[model samples]
Target: MASDFDDPGYDYAVSVAGRAVRTMAEQRIPPMPTNFAIWFQYYAGSHNNLRNAIDLLIDHNRPFDVSTNQDLFETCIAPEVSAVVVETSERLQA
Candidate 1:
């Protein structure tokens, strides 16, 4: 749980949904609305396995370099596609 997640440019919604979309690609899952819903639900779950890693990082109170942002996203959120979920969640979070 390093402060890397606290980057000044960080957008929580973008990070979450961006990962979902990247997960879709990595899993070869189509980016349909229904599928997106499933991915987002899992990301948002209180006991989410993926997010748990993030929680653990925070619990450790570690510090990460800004250069590790992609690693943070892939390891905690999704993969290395992009950093903006510029569609639905973007609008919703806004």
Candidate 2:
């Protein structure tokens, strides 16, 4: 059977990954999973709130310190992570 997933292929994936890493380095954000997720989403244009929040921070010359990263992850990514966990749990139970 054919897959439904729309794979962006290896090259596109590599480009996005590179951009994510570069962004993290530029912002001095650690290469933690949550931080990478934020940047990847930002470059991918997947999450507008995250993109806007980071942009606003940049505009204000605010540092992406630990507290800021935590806040952004919780506000933007935690809910999605929670939903995925719940869905995976349900599937496993079934």
Candidate 3:
């Protein structure tokens, strides 16, 4: 799969993700879609999560796209995410 994006191959990531999304779209199993939604929601924390989710979806024979995971971690947080308090305060003042 890694080789798909490099020499001897190109857009392998896109291909894999596309296949995963297609597989998931055609799934007929119960609790499977629910499980997928739950995991997908949890992985929305970062771009890596998106990539990992795509990988998981592909491994499970579903369709997905790596770009869908883009900018997953672009948010700027404080050293401990405590900066939210300050951000909220500033927003309120504005």
Candidate 4:
């Protein structure tokens, strides 16, 4: 199993989440949560499946919320859009 951070094809948003989590851990700063590492792991294992998951989330009219444990009203919603960039990159690669 590849380390979550080391996976080359890992989703970009997921990778950002990983970095956010790491920053939170190392600097004691709050990060955008939402099981991003799980997303990373999933992307590493299967890009297409991850894409489908992203698509389903998009089709349902969601905000791609990443804040699992933060103030709902305080979190920035646009950063969440990065998930699209990540998924699109992966699909392009495929």
- Local accuracy by lDDT, each model: 0.51, 0.82, 0.40, 0.45
Candidate 1 — worst ten consecutive residues by lDDT sum?
1-10
Question: What would the per-residue lDDT of candidate 2 be over residues 7-26, giving only the tens digit for each residue?
Answer: 65789778988999998898
**Each prediction's TM-score versus the true structure:** 0.38, 0.83, 0.22, 0.27
Please identify model 2 stretches exceeding 4 Å from their true place: 1-8
Tell me the lDDT of candidate 2. Answer: 0.82
On residues 4-79, what C-alpha lDDT tens digit does candidate 1 reach at each position?
2234344765776888798768656567664564455446453265456545655886433333333444554542
Candidate 2, position 29, lDDT: 88
11-63: candidate 4 lDDT, tens digit per residue: 76567556646634653434334444434433444445444655564588544
Name the lDDT of candidate 4: 0.45
Which whole-number lDDT from 0 to 100 does residue 9 have in model 2? 76
Give candidate 1 regions above 4 Å deviation: 1-10, 47-94
Poorest lDDT segment (10 consecutive residues) of candidate 2: 1-10
Report the number of the highest-TM-score candidate: 2
Candidate 3 lDDT, tens digit per residue, 1-94? Answer: 1211133234654454445455445553223433343333333333344456556666987533332322222322122134555666887999
lDDT of 3 at 27: 52
CA RMSD per model (angstroms): 14.4, 3.8, 12.8, 13.7
Candidate 4, residue 25: Cα displacement in angstroms equals 18
Q: Which run of 10 residues does model 4 get worst, by summed lDDT?
A: 69-78
